[model samples]
Target: MSSDSRRFVSQLAHNEPVSQVFLASDKQLRPNRNGNLYLQVDLSDRSGSVNTRMWNATDNDYKAFDNGDYVHVEGATQLFQGNMQLIATRIRKARPDELDEGDFITLQSADIEKMRTRLTEILEQIQSTPLTRLAKGFLKDDAFMDKFCRAPAGMKNHHAYQGGLLEHVLSLMELVLAVAPKYPQLSQDKLLMGAFLHDAAKTDELFYDRDIGYTDAGQLLGHMVIGVSMLDEKVRQIVQQDGQPFPERLLIELKHLIISHHGEYEYGSPKLPMTLEAIVLHLLDNLDAKVASFSQLMADCPNSESNWTQYFSQIGRKLFKPEKED
Candidate 1:
């Protein structure tokens, strides 16, 4: 299909006929009540993803494509319990010539480069010598920097696209710069570093070549624990270069920022925010993610005429859409 004629997932409406190629992930084949197999998968593009189900699927059909493969689907959109999903009649692996790769890319190379430049500019604002050294260590690692610039901030929720991690960190750091001045007691340097490092390990935690998913380390240790270890590695490099020991208390505080940034135990934080910077980081992190999620929801809502979106069971309410000013 021509790019101009392509309809994105976000533009799909109820009862709409869909014939397009999408990057597929999270495929599962399971037996229904009648012992017939059904294929469940997520079809995604740069806009967003839609959960898809294809009934009466065979084992060969499931093996025809991998999680990261592009698939051509013939389906119809439907509302299932307040959510948009696709009921597919036919699905098969897409040929190389069938689709354009640009359709699946959310961030271009120029966008990533701009964000990388902004990230370096913000990290340069750190005044603490030890923190500066730690930040420099991370920046100098070309391999790590590549992944940091390319990894998604999440698998499905907010900022779930290539270069999303860098975008999120830059936005969070900007928020730190803005909010810290209002609260003079908070250390801007510490908070900025916390924002940079909070989700840094997600680069390693997620595998995002075509489809976003968790690595084995991410499933076993998670990004928070891995972040602490990453911080220690950078700190070790700094110590070896300067022959001066990094501050014990500062290292502990940085590690605490990563582990507690989730805020609550139910949210996967191992410890609650104890310090002023930690608490601020947690709150701001949540604020950024929620704003992004809500914004995406509004943009992706199918019923453009409705003032409120369909009720989302995850959040337990419909989101109100304010009318746009001309």
Candidate 2:
């Protein structure tokens, strides 16, 4: 199919026919109640993703492609339990000639470079000598920087595309700059560094060459644990190179920010936000993630005729779409 005929996932409406190529992930072949097998997967473009099902599928169909491969899908979309899903008639590995790389990338190369430059400028603004050295240590690691820019902030929620991690961090850093000025007692440098480091280890935690998924380290330790370890490594490097002792209290506070940013135990925070800076970081992190996720849901909602989006089980409510002024 040509680009002109393509219907992106975000543009799909209820009861529309779908014939296009998409990046496939989270695939499974399972038996139904009657012992008939069906194929289940998520079909995605840069816009967003939709859950898809192919009935009466076989083992051969499941083996046709891997999780990250591009596939051609012949389907129709329908509203199922207030959410949009595709019912596929045919599915197969897409031919090389049928692919468009730009369709899958959320951010272009130029966008990522611009974000990286902004990130560097923000880090350079840090006034604390020890924290500044630590930030520079992470910046100078070419391998880590490359992965950090390419990694997604998450697998399915906010900023779940390549270069998304960088985008989220940069946005959060900007939030710190804006909010910190109003709260004069909070250290802007600490909040900025915390924002940058909070999700920095996601570069190592996730494998994002194609489909985003957890690495072995990510599954076992998660980003918070890995983040503390990463911070320690950079701190050690700074101390070894400068031939000086890093401040013990400052190091503990930085680690506290990382470990407590989740905000609660059920949310995976290892510790409560005891410090004022830690509390602010946790709230800011949550505010940014939720706003981004909600905004994406509004953009990707398929019910064009409705004033409200389809009920999202993830957030447990439907989102209202503001009427556009002419």
Report the error of model 1 at residue 43, Å.
0.3
lDDT winner among the candidates? Answer: 1
lDDT tens string, model 1, 1-326? 55788999988899999998999999999999999999999999999999999999999889988999999999899988767899999889998888899999999999999999999999999999989988899999999999999999998779999999999999999999999999999999999999999999999899999999999999999999999999998998889998989999999999999999999999999999999999999999999999999899888888788999988777878999989899
At residue 42, give the lDDT of candidate 1: 92
Q: Relative to the unseen true structure, what is the Cα RMSD of model 2?
A: 1.2
| Model 2: lowest-lDDT 10 consecutive positions | 1-10
- Across 1-326, the per-residue lDDT of candidate 2 in tens digits comes to 55566788888888999888999999999999999999999999888999999999999999999999999999899988877899999988999889988888889999999999999999999999988888889899999999999999999889999999999999999999999999989999999999999999999899888888899999999999999999998888888998988999999999999999999999989999999999999999999999999999999887778899988887889999989999
User: Which candidate ranks first by TM-score, i.e. highest?
Assistant: 1
Off by over 4 Å in 1: none
In angstroms, the error of model 2 at 6 is 1.5
Model 2 CA lDDT for position 61: 91
